[model samples]
Target: MEITIEDLPGHTKASLSGRFDTTGAIAIELPFNTLANERRALVIDLSNVTFMSSYGIRVLLRGGKIAMSKGAKLVIFCPDTAVSKVLTRAGTSDLIPVYPTLSAATAAVS
Candidate 1:
């Protein structure tokens, strides 16, 4: 997976590309957690993510917990239908908010 981070007005945006399977989760776990730990507001862009697995859900849940513990916010935006279904079915969409747009995601975290 490819992860690109950008600093926005009131939040940090992390754009993820490639499959969010086990390998992808491992590839991004550390850095993603680091951002969750450090940033007060983190908005993840899932527009480019092609697939997701249980491992990906784990990473997101962990990140969300880490951010919450730090009194921070972490949200995802622009997940395509496939990815969105995975998240929804896994019940992660309830724990971590998912927005339809970057602006909505950023505004939520802000």
Candidate 2:
């Protein structure tokens, strides 16, 4: 997977692309962790993501736990493709809260 980090006004958004599996999840975890420290709410954009595995959802849940502990939120946007469906099938959507778009995710977090 390819992750592009963006420093938003009061949040950090990570735009993810490609497949996110156990192997790719390892590489992406570091960047995701670094971005988590940026703001109270961490936004993950999955619009460009093509696929995701349960391992991917596990990575996300870890970050989500960290954010929650810090009184921060982890919001996911563009859960339209297979990536998002994987999360949904993994039962992470209720745990992390998935939104339709970036704006909606940001707005909900704000």
Candidate 3:
């Protein structure tokens, strides 16, 4: 997996590409958590993520909780169908909002 972070006007965007399985989740966990720790508003771009596993969901849930505890928010955008289903099934989508477009995600965070 590859993680790219960009600073937007009112929030930070982190784009994840490749599979979001166990290995991928491990690879990104630290940086994702770091962003949650530091950023007030975080937008996660998952359009390029092709696959997601339970571990990936765990990572996202952890990040969301961390952000919330810090009085921050984390949202996901552009998730493909497979990833979207995984998130929904895992109930992660209920805790963290998922948007169909980047604009919508950024707006929610903003």
Please report the candidate that would top lDDT against the real structure: 3
Clashing residue pairs in candidate 2 are none
- Give the per-residue lDDT digits (tens) of candidate 2, residues 17-93: 87788888887998787666546878898888777887888888888888888888889996577667777877899
- Model 2 spans > 4 angstroms off: none
Candidate 3 lDDT by residue in tens digits, 17-40: 999999999999999999999999
Relative to the true structure, how large is the alpha-carbon lDDT of every model?
0.92, 0.82, 0.93
Q: Compute the lDDT of residue 4 as modeled in candidate 1.
A: 99
Provide the RMSD of all predictions against the true structure, rounded to 1 decimal.
0.9, 1.4, 0.9
Q: Which window of 10 residues has the lowest lDDT sum in candidate 2?
A: 33-42
What is the overall TM-score of model 1 with all chains considered together? 0.96
Alpha-carbon runs more than 4 Å astray in model 3? none
Model 3 lowest lDDT segment of ten:
78-87
| lDDT (10s digit) by residue, model 1, range 1-110 | 99999987888999999999999999999999999999999999999999999999999999999999999999999645899999988899999999988778988988
| Candidate 3: C-alpha lDDT | 0.93
